[model samples]
Target: MANEVTTAPQDTRKPAFWYGLPVGYMSLDLLPPAERLMEIINQLRGLPEQERDEADRALRLYAGIISLLNTNRVQECALGVHPDDAGGFTTSVFTVSTLPTSGSAKLVVAGLAGSAADGPDEGMRPLELPCGVGFLAEKRSPAPRSSRHPERSDAASSHIWQGTVAVAAPSTPELIVLQMVTPDLDSADDYRNILLGIARTLTFTDPARAMAADEDREPEAPTGASAAMRNDFG
Candidate 1:
């Protein structure tokens, strides 16, 4: 697996905002579960007849379902904020179709505290970003060689590209993690480039600054009876 990390200066704009995917790409939310399942079945049908061993077929199906479930979990995580004692975390995922022949890509975002660190036992490789650090890793599972076609034997691979950004905050440092996985190595580079571009748009703001900004805003007048009295007197 090949891994690389690029960094940029911190953006102090919106602390929280939505990230968009490239054109020609779509999220799983746009596709219903039943439709997605049918797509998977279609992909399986495209596999060569020799590659249709029971074990291999089962593994491919399992992997597809697992990816779908994981993406759903991330989407649920994105719906709310998670604040911890020091800081908190939230995440989201989007499944994209790059091309008909090229496999889909999974984009993920994880927001947390910069103070927390990765464990040594973790198998992920380190990726340094301007705000913080990140990790990247890949996994491969060898498909059982077809008894008929001995010459063709390449294992299926999944590339996981992940990065962490440590936003500059006064007390509790905010962190953001961006990740994307491409099941097919042939188009992994394209997916990686798309994710990197999205990661670049991340901006951070200090909690203190946000609070102060809120305080500076003028208070709204009371409504109904209070508003009528104020309008009549003033």
Candidate 2:
């Protein structure tokens, strides 16, 4: 069995594999999720005072809701915010989970496809990931209860975009699932592409094996040494 961890190139302490999330995504997996979120929010600079205040309250609510929903199976989660180009922010929630048990990749895809087909507008299709085979499921639906505005009765009419990717572990029966949710339906295509790009970076491998492979790679010889070695060999 391999341990799952998302890491950056500069941080070797967290090993195994890392998701290449683009800029503007703030990780919330650190201890005390709310504090981590606040720290990230406070680090942001140059926003108007009122806008910054509103973002603070919104993120606090978002973090609170997320903390309640996250389960033990969730390996990683992050919140991404980007300019909507309409003076407001487009927010996204991204999570990666290890499913309980599934026989194989094919079975998992079949199961997902069956369920996805039942939804009126949901669609599922096969996807070839860099690490393994998987499927992509997408659907559009009314915003969740938490997403609705408290003061607006018509807020429920708003729609959200949900994209999910399920990839099988290379050497295990486990399925690594990545899901992204955003209420910015206008940018659905862009979000779908972002989700697919992140899915391709998912890999399942033992830390020890990955480190050993790096060590086994051939080192480049110095320029002069390479010529001398070539002449000597000739």
Candidate 3:
């Protein structure tokens, strides 16, 4: 044996998208019509100040946990119709990820709405919504487009349930899927309106990409309660 030294394999893991508030969501290609989003904002504006304050508070609370935007890497997007729209209005995108946390168990949000092919169903449950994109992208960091993120040391925990919000029919849910790397889908939510915001603000809608995401993919297995999570919070 010559001069040989062994080193543990490098921990080569990377995030799929930029950091964002664990509360609000980011749409890939699934952008909604300007008119609709404006309507929503208007409606929110119309809400009693108390209710609007609550929504704003929830957003800010989640923002505290999110990191920042990283516009360097190439992310995915999709567009689809509102479940209630008999006309099938297409908008929005979904990203392929593990989960955003370190959980071992999983959750699923399947129903009259479609099921996820890539992961399992933890059954329908309110996810810690702030533990999602909204909280992840709270503030923008100084890192480069594709640079590594500062450690998530300050990331605080919050409890924002992913409760069910029904739509008309022929409907699939707007899912916020979280997986534990041994990777069971920990949670899924009907986040249509939640995600619709991202789609609404963005441009260039793609149907093909959206279809691919919704199509069934095999579920990922998980490790201990310490595995990585993609947190596909679409």
Considering every candidate listed, which one attains the maximal TM-score? 2
What is the Cα-based lDDT of residue 114 in candidate 3? 38
Each prediction's Cα RMSD?
A: 18.3, 10.5, 20.8
Candidate with best lDDT: 2
The stretch of ten residues in a row with the least summed lDDT in candidate 2 is: 225-234
Give one digit per residue, the lDDT tens place, for model 3 in 1-234.
Answer: 011111111132222122222232234322236686567567778789999988766644433422111131113322233333354332222332222222312222222223423335443223223223111111112322312433442242222222222211111112222111100012212343333232222211222343354455564542211111122222
TM-score of 3: 0.21
Candidate 2 lands at a TM-score of 0.62
lDDT of 3 at 220: 53
Which residues of candidate 2, in runs, are more than 4 Å off? 1-17, 33-67, 70-72, 110-122, 146-149, 153-157, 206-234
lDDT of 2 by residue, 1-234 (tens): 112336421123344354456666777753465676567776654578888787777767766755654544566678889888789888898877666464775577667656655656447876776565688988898775643556573644478899999876654566778899998888889888878867755654443455466567776542221222222222
Per-residue lDDT, model 2, residue 197, is: 67
Candidate 1 residue-pair clash tally: 2
**TM-score of candidate 1 versus the correct structure, residues matched by position:** 0.31
Which 10 residues in a row give candidate 1 its minimum summed lDDT? 98-107
